[model samples]
Target chain A: MNPLLSARKVSFGYGAGDVLRDVSIDLHPGEVTILLGPNGSGKSTLIRILSGVLPSRAGEVLLCGRPPRGYPRREMARLLSVVGQDPPVDFPMTVESFVALGRFPHQGFFGETTPEDRERVRQALAETDLYGLRDRTLSTISAGERQRATVARAIAQGARVMLLDEPTAFLDIRHRVAFYEIVTRMKEACGIAALVASHDLSLCAEYGERIILLAEGTVASQGTPVEVLTPGNVQAAYGLAVSCDRNPATGAIRVTPLRGMPAKNR
Target chain B: MTPRARSEDGRLRPGPVFVLLGFALAASMALSASTGPVAIPPREFLDALLHGGAGTPARVLLSLRLPRAFLGLLVGGALATSGVAFQALLRNPLADPYILGVSGGAAVGALTVALFLSAGASPLLPLCAFFGAALSALAVFLLARRKSGVSPERLILMGVVVGAFLNAVIMLMVTLSPPGRIPGALYWLMGDLGLGTPRRVAVLLPYVAAGVVLLFLLSRGLDLLLLGEQAAFQTGLSVERVKTATYLTASLLAGSVVAVSGLIGFVGLIVPHGARALVGSGHRRLLPAAFLLGGAFLVLSDVIARTASPSGELPVGAVTALAGAPFFLYLLRRNGGKS
Candidate 1:
């Protein structure tokens, strides 16, 4: 099958610098794509461009078979759910109400939530393991729970594609794994496509079928975990020396770096 | 959340509140009709309302108190709802009814009408207020537009400048106005409710109703917009379109209130803040609650304004300012760390 969404010769930038240049990538159905980069290397920027939050300055984005602009706002929303990395939303809304927001694009602006909408919200909360905390206020929750809550909101949107920015920033290793498994279940159960930006290479090694690395506003390298997360390529992009190895039991790539190794050894 | 708990919102709790508010507002309006200048007893007030009482009491119930209280209700609801929408649109806790310079523009417009018009119930002051408010809104919108979009900062910034200019224009118009006419103009600045007759309320009703319904309809979009512009845009809301709709709707609502009652400050600011504390910020609940509480608040304030001191009456706006400024300080202290 053709890729579900793709960026064609997409180049994006802010004032004085290019964030991503001539980057062409396809996000296929049933495949998880990870965008990896150093802090300022523009993975988030590319994610925004593909999600249609930030327009591409130089190229085109296609969702399904049409241009990004072709889909109506509500229809586009039905196709993709984006969870941004924002400090907790300032409102102290209850967790369920916050999650209910995901149902906005799906339930038309005027209609009440149908039974299907209710089921989707239930399914999302169960997937994120947030069912018990549904009645609690957002401020009372832990950071990991809040992050998961936001992810659950996206799932409640019932979108086929999910764009996540640093989804695990607030999670501990155990919760992070728990979170990814839920995402894996979401993919398997719902066929939702996921494009996540992450600093953790192991996440891609564990969950991603493909990876794209960005450096200095350009796609430096992209391939499967074995090819893209290699020490040479990642080190070049991150400007640091790192070790990459596949876990024999899990088969996920684990990356650890000597913090300040010499350039020659890098 | 065992399914029972998960269904809290879809259950009776949230829905019942609306029903209760509607009953309470209707009762309050009837109560207001009984008190006014003539102090008509309830029986006569109802008789006057239904069959027309004997002379001044009849005129008082029909011509004065009923119209005044109804205007107060409509204006109060409009301002409160506008305040909620504008605050969410700005994503700032401190925003209120006058944030977009509607009050300042109305002041100038009212002053202009005071200075020039003969003022024999000629629709001049309301017309002037509407234009001034509309002009200020357009100016603020234009000034706030940015390359990315119209950011809240730009809107607030433009409002401050244009609001200052409008204030200056108001003072100039007041100075040029005849000294005898100044009291009436000053009454408006202090927010008088004595003047909004049935005619005034009738004139403003359509705008108020349309603006409020627009906000209620856009409540979902407004909820999404609260998640910051980029988040809102990515979620399929046209950020620009929603922002424009919200700003214009808010401006129209505030302007309509200003046109009739001058700048009644506190009900707009305090009512929403109070409702937010109780209902949380989900516009679905908060917006309607704010409107109801705001309506109740102003009617009560008008009662206080009319009855207190007994040396005639204090301006309703002054009463609100006295109350609101303190609440504003509290909000400032609460949000100080955030700013």
Candidate 2:
């Protein structure tokens, strides 16, 4: 199947140094792609580049065969949505109202909310387990709940592709699992192409259909979990000793760091 | 629980609130029209308004008081709507119409006409003031903007810097002027509705109406703006375009008002907050609510300015500042705890 989103040798930098260099990836519909990187490995920057929030310094990124910048903002948003790490904290708005804003692209500039828009917002709130907290102000909610609200907003956008930057960073384990489940369900139901930037190695291993491990502005490894989550690749990328084993319950690759550093780092 | 929860969605039914505010504005205008040194009774004021009687009370009510009240309404409503737009554009609740250098630029333009041209009460003054305001607003926006984008903090900082410099220039002009060349310039600087002729009111109506309507149309964009720039852009808003339109429209409203009625402070700053408190922060509702509330507030303040003392009239700005400063402090204290 053709990829819904593709990046070819995308490079970006701020000031002098490059944050990402020669990075390429593809995300096909009905698949979850986990982007793995340490701090400053340009995961967030790459996501921004792909979303057209920031232009790449070099190389190409295409969403549905056109450069992201080529599409009008609303048209681009109708196809792809992004969930950032932080929810808007400055304004006083309820969760329901906030989530409904994701329907902006679908609605006319002066359009009132249609029943379909309402239904989508309701379903997004329900899926994210935010129905109970929909009336609560975003500022009044807990960080994890706010993060879920952010995800709910993106889900309400009804986009074919979703790029989430550490969306579950503040979520608890249960919510984290639920988040993955929601993405998986969406993948199956709507065939969305999701690229989630995360540090949840084992969790993403179980959920992500493809994994791309990035190290120092370059792709260290890319493939299925077994091919990319090996001991040598993890140590080489992260500079830490880690043992990769299989989860007994699900038969997925599990990565656990050893007590000390790797011999090369030492 | 479900019913109560649904009601808590922050969407206050806007219809009743609008009716209440409209009534309040009408009542305030009547109160302003009735209260003066002459003190026309409400019955006679109503009679004069309907029949257009050619008596002293009718003459005062029609020619002087009603025009002044209508001018106050336009000025206050324009200032408040401008404030709401500025607040949304900057993504900061503290932003006011004059928070950019618009007010200072208007003052400088008025001063230049007053000092150099010796043009007293000429219509050319307002036009010059508007040009000055637009120029300064554009300067602030351009200075704050970088290749990446304009950050709200940087925009506000540039506004402050430009405003202070313009203020200094104003002071220099006032100080160096031959004392007799600019009469009532100080009072004008302090803000007054005394110049609210029927012609002035007619002139300002289209500006306020256009600005308010434009802002209403951009209400959805403003709602998304509170989400911050990147988030708004990601949500399908053309963020920069919206910001540009909002800034220009807001500047036009403020500059025109300042030209007609000199530097009225605090109405722009405080009225939006009151409106937000009444209706939620949805711009479509917030803009009208703020406009009505501001009209009522300023008309009442004008009444107080007219009648508060046994002496001559005080500038309307003095009355607003007297009320607004303490309320602004209270808001600051309350919001300080939240951040």
Candidate 3:
């Protein structure tokens, strides 16, 4: 019933400028939380803080009961995983080997691959539909396939929570939908909580159980999509004229931008 | 279970490749022992081995040729292993063992002992060279580090700067040294295995063993490091700790080898690429593959150095550079725009 991960008034800055200020968020088990914001709106920064990759300038982050940073890196990784924007392609690594890296936290420094580890990797590959391409090197794969590999890696981590930073940025429409479906399946099947940073408003409304809209390094709105995706909120946060309605088929909030309007704060 | 995770590691399958490389290494060692100035025919070589090795051919094989071949194996294996560690640490395939000025520092150390401290071949020369290499490597690491983290770009740049300064020092020492000191200093600089006695091989064995083992243990960590710093950290690798350990261990390997055999170039730079081609990039396999392949490559090069010209032996460094530079250029051309 309680939140699996929570950030309280987390603030972060670089040099003289602040990137995130007074942002608080929570992720519960088996929930799909969509984080929406324009570019440089502190979405990635917040994800980094929540994932313990960056220390918050102020406030705190708690994973389960303790601070995320208090745990050793591997222990923390056992509880949470992250999917970043891009996958590394500098070396020749098969997709299977790349995904198997997620098992590091579970394996000892000198440990051999256990049957369980291999099973997990195989399952992750199968779940992400990467089994066919597992033999191919990362350089030979498409960007969407690479993104899915990142997701597969997180899935293989077997973590309770996942934080994704623009995971669908390079995905085409079908893959974008498939990405959400995979996350949804993971949530339903494993009770894993996921926070996805995205710009796809309609998809977020359709798939995200909760939404946190950020603007100017602050949470402008946090609620169900129908409550937060209003015309006034979108216009204020994005400085664009837009209409908000419901998708007739899915009963999800639909946002449409009006053309030929002189936008403010452009 | 996804077809039981595929039994083989692609077409290369490290087990058989390891066996093949092991045989190649043994054959190269045999050829090296037999092909020196005193050519010991196979029959005589076997007779000496089976007998007490009292004959002249047996003495050359046991006392001179075998020790030098073993030295080549250790030196080549260490350099290639160090190269693998450095490449993983920097997350750059072009990174070599000497990229962080360890070799320059080593050269300075050997030159110092030759020009100022020792009158002749001193036992303390290798020790001094190692300390010099370690000190310069530490200096580069400290210079590159910031509060945020040690960025690979910053580390490489600092290495270049320190290496250049050390080179200047080496030049000044070589230029101003008494004429008698120059030959000893210069020969060491060029790199040779002529000094590979049983004692020298014994002295180097422990260092090479310890360094290679440590690197092998850190193989998984190194594998994660190729994911880049942030991703490696997120994946539960203590990225900074692993990088620091890799830097120190790799420096140790390069430094100790430099002390024993002088500065051997390109074995570190080229062997890992060849090994990677054979076994893919998994460090667990790649490290051993590189070590064996490097051993074979250097011993073969040394064989050519010993017999290529009738006049005298060429420095193995010269041979490696001659072959390695052309291969290096070809690699550069192939990888030009890809990176």
Best by DockQ: 3
lDDT of 2 at A241: 82
Candidate 1 lDDT by residue in tens digits, B185-262? 778777888886878888778878888999998888888877777777766787888888888788778876787788
> How many clashes (backbone N, Cα, C below 3 Å) per candidate?
2, 0, 0
Best-to-worst DockQ order: 3, 2, 1
TM-score of chain B of each: 0.86, 0.88, 0.88
Q: TM-score of model 2 relative to the true fold?
A: 0.94
* Per-residue lDDT value at B26 in model 1: 76
* lDDT-better candidate, 2 vs 3: 2
Residue pairs of candidate 2 with colliding backbone atoms: none
Q: What C-alpha RMSD separates each model from the true structure?
A: 2.8, 2.5, 2.5
- State the lDDT of candidate 1 residue by residue for A131-171, as single tens digits: 88877777678888999898888888878888889888898
Any runs in candidate 2 off by more than 4 Å, and if so which? A260-266, B1-11, B113-127, B138-158, B175-183, B330-339
lDDT of 3 by residue, B1-339 (tens): 344433324436667789999999999988888886687888989987688478898999888998999999999999999988888887766666565788889888877887788744456766777778878978887999899877656776898899889989988988899887656556667778887888889878888899999999999999999888888889999988998888878887888888778878888879998898788888999999999999998898899988998998899989988977787667656656665
TM-score of chain A of each: 0.93, 0.97, 0.97
TM per prediction: 0.92, 0.94, 0.94
Q: i-RMS values of the candidates, in order?
A: 2.4, 1.7, 1.4
* Interface quality of candidate 2 as DockQ: 0.66
